[model samples]
Target: MTCAFILGAAVWPGGRPSPTLERRSLHAAQMYHAGRVSRIMCCGGLGRNAPSEADVMVEILTGAGVPRTAILIEDRSTTTRENIAFGLERLGMSDEIVLVTDGYHAPRARAIARSLGIRCTSDSPAHKARPRTILRESGAWLKFLWQRMRGI
Candidate 1:
């Protein structure tokens, strides 16, 4: 089976998904409707909020018309590496994977997945990165490289 891993983003206060999170989830739903993937795995943990990112994704996805059975949740990861690691660990490496995220984030996500020995393709939502977002991603790249060097 093919599964699209929808990486989590911030969940606003009061259990709302951030715009980025909603976009990612909706993109995954589109993938499902287009027959690109048979399953959707929502990956994320609690982030300064009540409901976890995975739970919010479930709500959005189901609201988007995806069946409950076709969705999987991994709500233990708080970072990109953990999102890929814990999610794949729970889902197993058997199914083909399609990593879903914003374009600016896809490279790091794909790199992390490859380091874990999973070969996968990726599809990203149309996102216009603000200057702040670009700066944040640059920092993330530095952190990822540092962790890789230390074998963390």
Candidate 2:
């Protein structure tokens, strides 16, 4: 069964889902309902706030009408690479999967998943990102490419 892995984003201090996270989790729910994936794995570790990003994602997915039984949480990862590594381990299967994140972030996430020998696809909610987010993701993508070039 294909699993959709929702990458982490910030959570409000009061455990509210950040806009990016909400979009990704909602997309995950839509994908699930459409039968694109059999399960959803929410991936992220705790931020400065109490609840982990995965926790916020789970709440959002369930609130969006995804069954709790179909959701899994990997709350031990803080970065995209860690998210893929730890999330794949938690899943315990190399079956087909999808990585859900912002458009700019998907390349790095996909590269990391591919490096781990995962058969994966990426999906974004197709929202325009803020200038700051684009800039940050650009730098991240460059780093990913450099690492790959260096065979790291």
User: Model 2 misses residue 142 by how many Å?
Assistant: 2.9
Q: Report lDDT per candidate.
A: 0.93, 0.90
Using all chains and alpha carbons, the TM-scores for the candidates as numbered come to: 0.97, 0.92
lDDT of 1 by residue, 42-144 (tens): 9999999969999999999999999999999999999988898888888997999999999999998899888888888889999999999899999999998
Q: After superposition, how far is residue 21 of candidate 2 from its true place, in Å?
A: 0.6
Score candidate 1 by lDDT. Answer: 0.93
lDDT of 2 by residue, 98-123 (tens): 99998888887888888777768999
**Residue 58 miss distance in model 2 (angstroms):** 0.9
